[model samples]
Target: MPVPSISTKKLIPSIAGKLALAGGSLVFGSWVLSDIVHLPGGGAGLLALGAGVWWVTRPSKPASFSEPSSLPGWIRRCEAVLAQFSELELSLGLDGLRSSREQELDRLKALHEPLSVGVVVSEGGTHPTTSELQIALEGVHSLELCIAKPLPVVADAWSWPQELEELDVILYGLPMPLRAADLLRLEQLPTDRPAWLLIRDSVHQSREARQEALSCQLPKQWCDRLLFWSGESADLRQGLLPVRSHFVQPSRSREITKQRLLTSLHRRWQAELEQLRRERFRSLLQRSQWIVAGVVIASPVPSVDLLAVAVVNGLMVKDMAQIWGCSWSSEVLQVVARQLGTAALGQGVVEWSGQALLGMAKLDGGTWLAAGLIQGLSAAYLTRVVGASMADWMALNAGVAEPDLEDLKRQAPLLVAKAAERERLDLPGFADQAKEWLKSQRYAGA
Candidate 1:
């Protein structure tokens, strides 16, 4: 007999699943021993077996260490964050971010009504092939095709031609024997829309020469988009199959093209917006870190530690979620804060900060003011790390309809580590900012 296989995307095995299985096995084994075999101490034996099974199958606690901001350490911290936060809370937080991000993405998609495509020839390239491609593309419904004469190849500051701006896609023609100027022109092209490079191989080259041309090291973005052209209509159509996939359809021609174009535009817009969002996230993180540091400086006792940080971070989380277009709810937000707080504690972030502050006091002649500065700085650093890791988490899981918190938890350590490593690179700048902040505080006090 042949065994049948089932495919599933749920690759990660959960503790809950293991526990359920163990419990069922225990129940069955107990019944067999106590009822059928008349075995002794069935209840006690069953309890022991259950305990053993749990001991073997239980999720391991996040590892701890005192390594100074290593990549692995950062990852461990991130994992601890996942373990610390409530699964439901983390899911909700990510879901909230995705909702807002997707909405903005959809809105941008709606605005992408690409009615035309532009064909621009490289400088010194012949116009015959450009005209031929234009004629061939005319049969493509709902896409206006326009041909442009060879433009200036070399410019220090390159900008897209005004005529090309309204076009949905660009089919750029390059002359045979590719020149450095042609590559430079390609490098200057806008990334907003798809740009296909049609290298007109008018004179047939040796197989080795053609291979070398195809293998010519262009940036990865332009690698697959460029191809050799024999100027044949069939070759042009076949080469453009992927681009045509965006809008070409026989049925409901107009509506299908628009809808497909919108979908394609949405993906591109999402990538562009993600870059913008990261910049905004960095600003938010910096502001939030300072807010945390300020709270630490103001508080005479540690009683205000978690509460003040929590309130500040809660608002930060809400802002981040909104930036990502995720829905916001206070209950889930609080849960996220609480869990991450627990992780920070479990991972010795609080202890590390306290020791650092004491060391600062020793170096600064034990002044209370100096101690406060160190404490605040340490708090600020912690905030920056946590906030950065959260941003990473949100980015990684953004479009997921139902985020698997357990899987995220398992990945936390690595994410936290990566964030820590990145933040570590900015340590000099971070320190300079802290010094400036300390000076301002001192001047204010004076």
Candidate 2:
């Protein structure tokens, strides 16, 4: 044989390996001998020796490949590739989105033009007063002020032509308190323009007088557009500038009042939007609570009801986030819901109310349907309390980070107690509403 190759397995053993092999053979032989001889102390000695040998000679674990210490190199590489692919896809999508947004912004810019304003003078006031307002407004060339006659007559006198439809704003000069008839006339006017209530009264008027002037109820739709201005503080000299120069002049002092008025209008619009959001939030929350209550009523399990409440509340938070124009993550809402649910449970309101309702129903010889109605109403009440608290929190911190859950938890019990008191007063009405809702559902299902 041409120089036989020596196998690695047949190579001479290291010191440690030799020791391990020798120890294993000796211990194994001793154990067998002790078993055959039945020696009293030898058996224990042999068992201990065998354990030592097994520990020493257990086939060197071969650097276990299955330990899960790290993912395979190929798997890591594949993951990196997938991540890059996802990033590439997102980048492409974002590019298209950015392009579309730029185009939309350009379109909006192209449509932007100067506002055309109309001034309406109250006949109850003198023509000199109308001339004074017209003279003051003459400074603003960017605005075309169409002077119309007083309240009741102005509705018929002012014509709304295709050109007039472009009127961006209206200023009403009211010297006296508005009557209901004046309000009706106002309602009849074109709604395309935002309206301002220019009170000709001096700002130095007594608090009582000012209060009396503003006491009249404006229509809900008009309240946002109807701003108040007083001529008491305006400089007489500053009021008579040419309308053409006013638009071009970059004088800060001249623009101050106009800027202030614009700022006030913006704030009013924001408030209106906020109010609408809250109303929508409340309605959605109530409907969600009702549905969740119905589901809980139908279900036999109590644990499932808790889960349902959490899920429903989480969804409500998402809706609220959209309403408030804030970013939301499901995780944050879940945390909030959990905290709220814990608070509700800790206060024992839900438990006590449910048990009390069930007891009353049982006393009245009630069926499952009666029990469900009680449970559903209780659920709706709890939801209302939670929703109210959430709305308050969102209103206070719109466009901010997610609310502090701990704060919500602390406030929830107190809110629930107050809600309970309110519900007690409104219970009769609520009962009738609930009854109608159930009937409608039954009819729909049928």
Candidate 3:
């Protein structure tokens, strides 16, 4: 199975092309067509001029990759891995920042919309990540960002002021060993609204924060609703405890390995899908295309039990009928196709199918049931007749498992008679061929 790599390469140059074509056409036409068309060389020259003009007038390609930005080697590696896996960035250091510290702040600025910001900064321990904090606080619906910035690092945690002001949201990014004193200070703070507290460390640290709150004399809202988040550097398993979690590509080898494993699994999925297509669902694809192309054959020998579903998206079904082989009947086919997920199909099926089909060819599947039916019906005509290997692979591969022959028998009761007739006549491929011919030929006097 081919794993579809994230594409960083741009396919086309946008504009500046139209202008070139327009100019080329005028130049070629006037230069070659000087002589009258009534003469021989005149006509030839006219056509030649027109050709030259069009060629020269054609648009010139545009430049790519805008400019060269010096990115750190580690940063480049991070970008590559993040592109493979959806990554979230944390932003820290707001006092040093002039405006919203987003990567694309300028792009957002052009909208000229009033920004909604949530700032929670304190002078304390472990500083927040600049990228991660900014990204987490960004809310598209409210067009606001709720950031937490602590004050200068100080040994005395309780030295901070009692009631702060202008805080849309409160975020705490202190160290792992949280003390009971931290909760007392938080309670003293002015805001009764929601407060986002950072709780890094492992399982032990999370338990400490919950314990600290429980021991305090704070109100029910403060004790019960206080949000505890594992700090940015904490492990993922540790971080999942918080009600809301943000994921960023870790700048480490272990995280990169995890991303690659995910990619491999994705590829294996595609390989299985493709194997099913070649083995049993190819006919369904061809038939679906015929329907879309609106062509009907001379006779309807086998019924196409297709079920059409209207989804929010239409691009999901490009040669998707292969899914029907998962279970026979157009109805089953359509359902599975829709279930494949629109997110997966955005990158094109053939490429993904090859990736998924690579290893799946080795796996045992019910898809052969459909192909077996096809072969069984085709056997009626021999001597330059159709053939199918429904049960032949396990015959040679030795390692292949025989499906419950009883279950295969139970799948399609009516098709059994058609298959037996073809098998007795020694032309097992007839069923598929007959269907194909039926779809391809047009009825003359319908």
Candidate 4:
């Protein structure tokens, strides 16, 4: 089971912080207005507070996913993802995959050849060694055994080759008293195939010691499939069952391996596609935030500012949905965006941004220009938070036919917090960008 990107324990605190910020912003902004513009403090405060509530809770019209321009880089990347999926399905024996050009297809067909197993030996000691395992498997037919050591580590991680097309099931050996380095290495191995960790124990080792060794931390996936082995021929033979099962019925075994491979391939490819989409989204997010900032600066009315930001964020959500291959209608995407956006507002993303802007005012000196900049940056940061949370939600639910908007509403605050935490790590970068944007605006005015 996949763990959610954001945890529930932190969700409450995050939402509370946002609400506090929102309330604080309303009170403070209204006070500042009353003091500076000479209006009755209470009336200004109440008006601002009311306006804030109305804008945030107001229902809006649905927006659609925008069509891509002529082969934009993102479109090309999306096409690449589709192509990878098509090839994977074709390799898994799916029919009706029409290629545009009448090119050759032998390479794709060759991927379905007879099953091959690889025995990966750890560097150190092991009972019923590779030679012994080979002797135990003397009579097994139709299985090509490839013997190899774990790939050498480069820069503290396993350096995998471009393709592992030849091997299907990898029987990885692990000596007793599993080292952290070995576990780290295991983590880097390709998950797109059946991998079994063979824990080797000495025949002379005590049962207590063996139990202690077995108690070592292992991931849940590896824990169930763990094979305990000693030097005895019976132990080795029994331990080999999982690996041998792959070759039991050569044809049936082939299909099973292909199916397993396909499932893992889908997961790996989804991650790859998401990573690519994330890179593209950075630009989209930056652009949306700047636009939101500009609008907020031009017209600082709370409702109008939020509405403009919402429109920009709606378009962003549609593009993200399309990027993640979501088939949901624009209405569905907008519901998701609204859910996350509301959470962002409730959690005080805008308030936090306003506070940070005010903090900068200590050095920059107080002015209405600074106030506009503050609101603009707040809206921009709110967009960033909402966009990030939406991206997280869509990525987790990418392949699901129907995503539950209620579940998103429940998870929205935690997701926003998690995204905010990550985005804040790049605060200096954002600050620098804001500076450059401000400078550019000044130059444009001149």
- Top lDDT model: 4
**TM-scores of all predicted structures:** 0.53, 0.42, 0.22, 0.65
Q: What ranking emerges by TM-score with the best candidate at the front?
A: 4, 1, 2, 3
The residue-by-residue lDDT of candidate 4 on 61-115, one tens digit each, is 2222233332233334344556755653443354443352112122322356656
Query: What are the runs in model 4 whose C-alpha is more than 4 Å off?
Result: 1-109, 112-114, 126-134, 150-155, 158-169, 172-246, 302-305, 313-315, 361-369, 399-402
Tell me the alpha-carbon RMSD of every candidate.
13.0, 25.9, 24.3, 13.8
Q: Model 2: runs farther than 4 Å from truth?
A: 1-123, 129-145, 152-326, 342-365, 368-377, 391-398, 406-433, 436-446
Better of 1 and 4 by TM-score: 4
Top candidate, metric TM-score: 4
Off by over 4 Å in 1: 1-117, 129-145, 151-171, 179-291, 294-315, 318-325, 328-331, 338-369, 395-403, 443-446
Report lDDT (Cα) of residue 378, candidate 2.
69
Better of 3 and 4 by lDDT: 4
Candidate 4 lDDT score at position 404: 71
Candidate 1 lDDT, tens digit per residue, 228-314?
Answer: 556687776666666566556533333433344444444444454556567677888888888777877787455434754585466
Going through the candidates in the order shown, the clash numbers are 16, 1, 57, 2
Q: By TM-score, how accurate is candidate 1?
A: 0.53
